[model samples]
Target chain A: MSECTKLEMKDLLPDLARGALAGPALAALEDHLATCASCRAELELVRAAQTVLGATPSVDTARIAAAVGRSSSIRRDATVAVAQARRRRAWSVAAPSRRVWLAAASIVAAVGVSVIASNTTRSPVEPGPAPTVAQVEQPSTPGPTTPEPTRPAAPRSTGRAELVMAGGVSDLADADLESLLRVLDDVDTELDVEPAVLLPVLEGDV
Target chain B: MTEPTRDGEPSDAALIARWRGGDERAATILVERHAPAVSRFVASMGERGEVEEVVQDTFVRAFGSLDRFREASSLRTWLFSIARNLCRDRARANRRAPTVVAIDETHLLSSSDPLSAAVATETESRLRAAMERLTETQRAVFTLRVAEGWSYREIADVVETTEGAARVHYHNAVRLVKEYLDE
Candidate 1:
């Protein structure tokens, strides 16, 4: 037999024993192996191995599923543990700052308490008598009893526009202002519509 | 709550979205659905003591990195990948310890008579011993193929090897296992 044929025969021997060969190929391989004792022994060994392997119990799907469930739980706990560890690390880093803030707040509070205590320990100062309203109404007293100095101006008539513009204001462009007023008027008119018809129209708009 | 979607069952994608939106039920559903697969994978790899804990860690890691998981493979496959890595880490950590045969007691009882089962267990123990004798890569290739029934291509993808190399490993593994068994 040719070298290529020998090689093909060796590969085919396993297939033949496994019943994987078919048609003319099976016939040719059978004819070659009939006279080949070495090939026959190899085929027997391959067959035995296949049988042994085939007899291996099919892994239990339920068991697999159970294992998968266990795996998921383990993974979840690990993640939670890792997250907890990170939180612990972060809290550790923040602890000194928290103490510093507490110290600062305590210092401020202590100073405040000391100031209040000092103020309370001292004697209270007496005040002069309060001024009468009639004394305050006198505009040109020029003495200790006189009211604080004032800049006096003559009263003038205030128009509606002047009162409206008293607060610093923008004069909008006429067309834009008119459109805004028209929108507001439309909104008012729409609000006056009956509830029944307004509902569908509002729904449609939405 | 809104009515169930037209498909009867909400898709995983929908469930994922709901979980992301803070639906606790969705999170629970996801956990209940996929946790067993991870557990079985770790168990098959001979993990014990804290198998459930490992499974939980795998899920939490998967959830935290759910954003990075670009649906390139099925969700199960993705989870398996995560689980496999976790198993590897656990295996490395325990390399110095004496290996323990942690076969399920019930599985051992249900497997034929006590004598035959004991012998089978011995054989399995031998097989495991032989497995230990092989390099980690060889054991991984052999287990993923023989135990998990992965195709060579699938093995290559999981093990990050060329397809041709995977085939060679499979052949090598078969030969080694047979030799070990015969002994």
Candidate 2:
């Protein structure tokens, strides 16, 4: 029989010691070990080390359980603290939407323009020939004053048309100015009515 | 709390699921079942006096990150991987602090059974010193193989190496340890 190489025997030594080798492999390994002094010695050393290492003292399970209990309590408290902090952060930042901001900006701009228009109209100027009371009272009707169009129409009177042209608000009709102010009033009312709903929607986004 | 079945205890996955569902006892059961093995693993890696603390930390960290555990590996293997990392961290921290000394047989001989303890302590001291001579990977592979009776595949998983490399490390470790003990 051929002598077993140390490398081949090294691979088999642990299995041999543990009785894992079976059938012809076991018989072959045993035959090889019978003549191999170094492999025998190496196997002995491995077994000895395994035995020594396996003798490590058992741990105290009760103490570990107690420690785990303490750790879990601490972790629970930390988690609760973190969740509370997140909630506080959510409440502190009322992030309005781009649409809401746009609406708000439109209202502010409209109010500023209205204020300027009213101020300019009221301003003292060199007295020109004042309009006759009859002209003011007659109500310069341009077309049949049909019930207000669902959408804004071009300014009908020359005076109104001049105001639109000078203001550069091509889309504005005298009647639609009242509608824009009403829409702004509705938006302001909605904001005041539902402050609570705003927070959950923003938090969901977060 | 679900009562443990009479035929056998629940699996680790079941326990983890229970723990996630708010049954604290499941967490306790998991700790009790796996803590000793983790402690032994840490101790084998040359950690002493604080094996319990490390094992506790491992469980706490494991539970905290339970959602990340895919259950692809056995829970015990996962715990060993965590314990190995904790050992590495502790070793680094201890290196930074000059005051801490490594524990040895003297620390282990505190048992009431003096005669057997003496014999065991001597053997353990020689083995530990021999292990100390090995590189970290060699020591880990050897200990996991011999001390923990792990297969090369399992050792590879814990040490983050291929099975062939783990076997190579184990053999090299065995030779070095044998030479050290022989001397």
Candidate 3:
């Protein structure tokens, strides 16, 4: 309760309760306990808790060990299988680092708000006035790629590559685009993995 | 069976390396040494029904991810953290986790006499009740320090709080348990 005059020894009540104190420390605690009513009561509380919660319930360790062994064996086998499968698919699979993932996330988030979220935007990191770098070129008409049931077919291509890729990039916005442009300035690795990851996230978040 | 290896026996590090090298018995020894404390901690979290299961899961999960474990850190604290997380997940799945509260139960001096065994027996149920009333983090913070005499830093590692926050939770738990006891 912090009311004990011998306040410094109070934190050690649990140790005293566990019989961890001995020699000079034990003597010192005893001397403090003889005078401090606050600490004595706290020590009592500590003991009561020890007695109540300290009773270790029996657990079946052998059973658990056997289960763990089986789990480990299965996992090892599965890992081996996965390694073989990975070797087979090594050409298709690209595991990006966390830094790469964050950069990609920034790009995806920016795309939903702005049309300018593209790799070509001039990075502020480079010294000079901002260049009129190519933006994520938008389809001027932006006609729905899928013709509406009520409307006739959209004009051919509408000068947009979106019609070919199912329009994932066009659906993104501007807020994260600026960030993507900035990150593109700093971390160039995201550029290599961008085309692979950007499409799926755009479809999901949009 | 719950007793740890005595002073002259192989250290936890050696056992861990052996276990990593596929010595199954080392895993068994680790389980034996840590199961009791893990059981007590899980039970204190008010997840009493699944204490054994949670303990088993803790070891299994820990063993599975031992490669990620920092080699020099205390394995016991790491196991405690994993058990704490498993219990929290169970509570979340059950939708029974109470929000953390800072309880103040000051001025509960019960005549200052040394507590007797009879009193300890009588208060056992109340103590259990008091423990149940504590927030999960409080119980996690309190039990490790009180029952095991762990440092606040160790408790912090288990409970996922800074050492200062662990100290505050420990005191708050002490006060709350006293309040429950007085009632």
Candidate 4:
């Protein structure tokens, strides 16, 4: 006897049972349900199902809060440990400038050999038909016309070593300075402490 | 009775300030306030064992990144989104859980509360079992709508689905759940 079909009631039945329908729609559902035995039974069934569903046990709040509290502690500890490990790993990698300096030192040594070989070729040293000193040193030679390779190489290596040492020294100085600043801050904080009341009495020899 | 620090539920901003000002108690309050609904949503998805863990994770993650919360939506909405993601992760890990079939009534009836745990007494367990059969989005929509009683638009935002899609899922889920229970 229902005018509304079962298919239309499929989704709306839940809403109807929930009392969400209003005005004509509510009347229409009511009118339909009054006539249709099957739809009426179906609505009852849905209502019953919802009742049981709504009765699903509430979660134990205390237990959940406790779990959250425990997890928070665990997370904080894990994060701190990971950060410390990353810092340790980062410091152990070779310094960037050291690699650059080593490459520059190799170039300087090659150029020095070139200069030494050129110098020997121009000297008054007599040789039988053996290979010239220039030819003997050819593989090590940087190039022709580059003068005073050994002189430049010595200063260049010295400068590089100085730069490397300066970098290391500055890093150590920063750390030392930071530590000193922290100690000074601590001392300043301690100095700000209010003196005991007995201090004035004792100082006055009372 | 003790009154809250303010009237009509403290805004998330107030709770966050109290939390940042070294109030461990405030953190506990926030956890207690949000955990039940978060746990319910997770549990409604049939994640019984890990529901507590997921709820905890939701809060811890939410608090850690509280600075990023923008307040575009309500704090509860943001928290629900976090909880939903965690639930999906749990659901994805195990595709299905065991269900109590009609034939398995004696097994369930013997082990649980006699009145409330009867196979046909409440539809919650059945609905939950039915939800576990749905795709994650559908289940999320169903739980948010039916269990938490959120609007379709709210469900959409929390689950990052379109409002239309959420409505569709809700309808589909309702139909499936009804059919399952009726059987």
Candidate 5:
């Protein structure tokens, strides 16, 4: 009988122990093992090692379950917290920009109102006291005898109407309205009377 | 054969699907089913005394990143891989390398006769000590092979090596273990 190589025998040992080899290969390996003392000892050693290692201690299933339960709960809570924080951060970022745009729109409205008031009263450009709400709201009919101000042609309304439509003016506060009118009064020296007068005419036509 | 589940339970994939769909019970089922195996693998890899903590950490990380899991490998293999990495990280954090210490052998040995039990216990202790003498990779390979009965290919995949390298490691490990026992 031809002896199997030690390498071949060693390779077969694991499969042999697992009862994997069959037919001629099994017969040859067993014949070789029966004759080889070293291989037999090696096989025994392998079996012993497997047996010893296979005795790994079993873990307590209940303890593991409880631990996992706690961990999952904590993780879920953490995820929710992170999501809420992100939403808050988004709102925090968005809130200020909305206020800024609204304030800008109010200032533009105040500028238009100041130009109309100046044209109607023909007031000299002085740092006069702020107009009362009743005076600002009072309509000035272009009287039959009063000369219409020599106003320049009006510029296109820079989409202020659209902005007003998108963001309603009712959200503006009283303090913001006062501050806007004050800023427009400060810029009255640079104001052209023609476009200011034509603005009302444009509105009347609309 | 269909892999058996405890008491006709659903498979891991099914459980994962249910959990994703907001079924809390499925999450509990998955945890109970795989946690022990993860603990055993962690302990076998020489992570003592906090096996449960490490296992919990593994599950937490696994659940957190469940969307990233492509399911190309079996869930068992994936969990083992995660457990192994956690053990490595723990070892690094502790600033201590993995050294093979004598594993508790009493759990593995059982005999009605006291003398046989004592003998079995001693033998298992000696074998475990010899196992400790192996490098981490060799120990991991050997345990996965002998204890878990994983295929060489599967061991290679978990260990991130070629099958040839895993075979070499296993054979070298077996030889060293045998020589230690002989001595």
Candidate 6:
């Protein structure tokens, strides 16, 4: 391809087309182009390529600019959104929803109402402490469940009747009357007989 | 040979500095100045139908790693280097043979010289076809050197070769184009 002796001069063809060659370089390229048809034709080819580039479709600068800018904003927005979501999660964990609080409150109120209703409606079934015979002796009203307790047919002559003579104490439950009479009678009879004999029976029950 | 625009606008370094300082308009100006040249280089490298996308990706990657870029270097050549890498990566991803896409005149968007557009489209197509016949490296060297008016050093940097290799590629490319056109 070096028909003209100066093949190295062909390298400057690009600069010549771009008008970058100046002073000595420009002078030299011109001096060599005077006799170099190979270099001249190559220069034409380079110029033609430059022309094609100029005429080719160009990308829309505005679109690319907007894309770059959007990346920054998108990152910022994503960060903010994540932070807000975390805050909401923490708040929900710290304080439960109002609906949950209301449901809990309703359960407590229902339990309290049931407890008070049971305490008032039923006899105070808290295990009645062992009543002293004196507390049970008051011939008070009939028992709640029986309405009228038949006089416990055991000894009316026994000193247990004297238990009734003993002053009536307050807050005596009529429910304990029958048992109280029978137990007091038995104890009186036992004391009269022998504590030695009752001990064996009580020990057997234990 | 690299310089500011004729109207005394800001240089690439100045724009990059402003962008780093959060003045976003500077980024727009930089894209406007360099995207056309990057597009031309990408198209000349046998990338068709995706020229704009490749150009866009090059800028995005360049700006993404702007902190690492040396401001003193030529941004245009740097963009060409990035575009070259992107085209290579895409070729590998596709795992298909490279095909030369013919340049369509109807796709022409803007031109500096209306007279050149009117008179030179057919010759331009012929030249583009001849360019497409060269090896990928030769076409890239030729494009950066002749079309973008880049020096052999800048071309070597883009194509990842020595300046001597770039010069040889350019010479071979010219000879091949001449042969093709003569046919």
- On lDDT, the candidate that comes out on top is 6
DockQ for each of the predicted structures, in order? 0.09, 0.34, 0.28, 0.19, 0.31, 0.21
- After TM-score superposition, the amount by which residue A133's alpha carbon in candidate 1 deviates from its true location, in angstroms, is 49
Clashes of each: 23, 0, 10, 4, 3, 0
Sorted on TM-score, highest at the top, how do the candidates line up? Answer: 2, 5, 3, 6, 4, 1
TM-score of each: 0.44, 0.65, 0.63, 0.55, 0.64, 0.60
Encode model 1's per-residue lDDT on B22-119: one tens digit a residue: 56566566666666545655655656556676676666666656666665445555666676778788888787675775644333323558887776
Error of 3 at A39 (Å): 1.0
lDDT of every model, 2 decimals: 0.54, 0.67, 0.68, 0.59, 0.67, 0.68
Native contacts recovered, in order, as a fraction for each? Answer: 0.00, 0.35, 0.58, 0.22, 0.40, 0.48
Of 1 and 5, the candidate ranking higher by DockQ: 5
After superposition, the stretches of candidate 4 with alpha carbons farther than 4 Å from their true spots are: A1-50, A53-63, A66-70, A73-94, A109-206, B1-8, B17-22, B48-50, B57-70, B85-136, B180-183
The lDDT of model 3 is 0.68
Worst 10 residues of 3 chain A by lDDT: A197-206
Local accuracy of candidate 6 as per-residue lDDT tens digits, A99-175: 35644554454444444433433334444333333334444636653221233344323333333333333223455
Cα-based lDDT at residue A150, candidate 6: 35
- Report model 1's TM-score to 2 decimal places: 0.44
Residue-level lDDT of model 3, residues B74-182, one tens digit each, is 8888888888888888888777746543321221223445575445445766777788888998888778878878888888777778988988898889889988887
lDDT digits (tens) for residues B108-164 of candidate 6: 434688887655666767777788788889888888878777778888888888989
In model 1, the runs with Cα more than 4 Å from the true position are A1-206, B1-18, B21-33, B96-106, B109-112
lDDT, candidate 4, at B52? 66
- Among all windows of 10 consecutive residues in model 2 chain A, the one with the lowest summed lDDT is A197-206
**Among these predicted structures, which one has the highest DockQ?**
2
Give candidate 3 regions above 4 Å deviation: A5-7, A91-206, B1-5, B96-121
Candidate 4 vs 6: which has more DockQ: 6
Flag clash pairs in model 3.
A110-A176, A110-A177, A111-A172, A111-A173, A112-A172, A112-A173, A113-A173, A113-A174, A114-A173, A114-A174
Model 3 TM-score relative to the real fold: 0.63
Which model is ahead, 1 or 6, in terms of lDDT?
6
lDDT of 5 by residue, A20-39 (tens): 67999899989988889778
- Chain A TM-score for candidate 3 is 0.43
lDDT score of residue A32 within candidate 3: 88
- Among all candidates shown, the one with the greatest TM-score: 2
A1-206 in candidate 1: lDDT tens per residue? 22223645655655676566799999988897788775675566555433333332323344434544454455455556555655665665565565566455544544444344333323145233333222323345576653322201334223332323221112233474476467545544533333343233222121
